[model samples]
Target: MTNRKIYRIALEVEAFPGMPTTAAKLLPLLENHDSTASEIESILKYDPGLTANILKLTNSAYFGIPTRISSVRQAIVLLGWKRLLQVVMTICMSPLMNKTIPGYDLPRGALWQHSVAVSVAAEILVNALKIPDADEVFTAALLHDVGKLILGGFVKEDLQQIESMVTKGITFDVAESMVLGTNHAEIGGQILGKWCFPAELVSAVQWHHDPESCDESCNLSDIVHVANTMGIMTGFGKIDQELALEHFGPVADRLGLAPENLEDMAQQTADRVKKLMVSWA
Candidate 1:
């Protein structure tokens, strides 16, 4: 019964409408090193609302631009295409993520805030660790809990059984899997796969809660795991005040982070997330 139910919920990911058209188009472009600013402007111009939000975010204090950015092309020029793509992705994701999530106990905008926080945390980790190949980390971190959107209803239905397991000293995600046959991390990977994301990114989300289980994308998974924990530790994106469930030591060691490095990263992530949320709110 649990397996069948999990299969049904997994199938629902195909119908999830949260990935905006602009985002879908832009995501592929982010991978193309040859993608030009005009190319980005072309896709965004059709979605004026997204363009406007992109401009607003580009001009936000987070980017530290000295001049005002009034146009997409101009913004792209000033912020560079890669940074502009990240901003566009953030704007495109906000509407769906801002909605209140049921089972996770996230209020309207809370999940979005937490996602942004995690994304920021991921960026900080990549820079601090100087992992040059981690360009996909931000997107992976942003969508790590996307499974919650699909699984929330099911979780609500099984809340009592899942909560019972949690009370027995099991972590929430583990309890979720035991009671529901799958957890959000696995479902989140399914969602990303349905969206045609890169394999590494899919792996990163799939094993974010269990980095040790991810072989090929272990480093990426480890970064996202620690980033999600940092988001929770900074007091954003908590599932009903649930503590950071993943152990910090092993993942930190894999990432070559000492305790003091984590403290510094946490402070930087919190400051950056707070500033970014100003425009996001």
Candidate 2:
């Protein structure tokens, strides 16, 4: 399908079932460098379900706080604004991402697991490399493959052809483009733009598969590219391994990461994913 057709399909879909209005309202607050705990708590209060998820997550073993968190404000205070925003985004997007995507060969919850893994990996890279805008990168990583959700049925239909191209040495995204006329990365970027996400995030999603194509000044796409590849290697999901490895070295180098450092970061990301899975459970 053409890009226009793909976007038309996305627009016709059910408004992405798990996109809470609360998320849209919370975006500005989360983006604000000086946003207060009370400001976050106040917005979350209107969404009882989201508020409950936040409190539950804050008290979970993953957070490891000494006392239980009973209220949104208390959770915010305990988790701090940045961490709280991560939890909220994870909670808000989980339901939509947790389902099976047979087109991509993802079983129920597999995509969600991969997303979490990538998010963790992005966080590790951000801190390790001392990159700024950790929250934006994390959120972008979590939603990096959202286009897969949109393209699932089409991919399922074209699976054999796409696989054949991959077997003939084409990268997965290239195969996807050949078969579907639009790759998941670009579709994901368009979807996020439609959702009113910041341009940084839209660019990250759009260019993660080919970070070299992103603007020279932004490292967010490069960070997500490395994280997504790491997540695939760690078995969060399957993809063309050769294609992934091809980009691995260059992407890591772009972030000034040595192989040893990248390996350590991958291990840290895996551990974080393990703890996060428990919290989700």
Q: Show the lowest summed lDDT stretch of 10 residues, model 1.
A: 239-248
Count of clashing pairs, candidate 1: 0
After the best TM-score superposition of candidate 1, give how far the Cα of residue 121 lies from its true spot, in angstroms: 0.6
Measured by TM-score, how close is model 1 to the native structure? 0.94
Candidate 1 residue-wise lDDT, 1-281, digit = tens: 36789778967876887568888888787678688877887887788888878888888888889999898778867887568767877887777778888987888888888888889999998998888788888889998888898888898898888888777888888888888888899998988888888899999999988787888867788889988878877778774433445567888887888767777788888988888978766
lDDT per residue as tens, model 2, 170-236: 8888788888888888888878887888888999999888877787435788888988877876778
RMSD (Å) of each candidate, 1 decimal: 1.7, 2.4
What lDDT does each candidate get? Answer: 0.82, 0.81
Poorest lDDT segment (10 consecutive residues) of candidate 2 = 239-248
Deviation of model 1 at 251, angstroms: 1.1
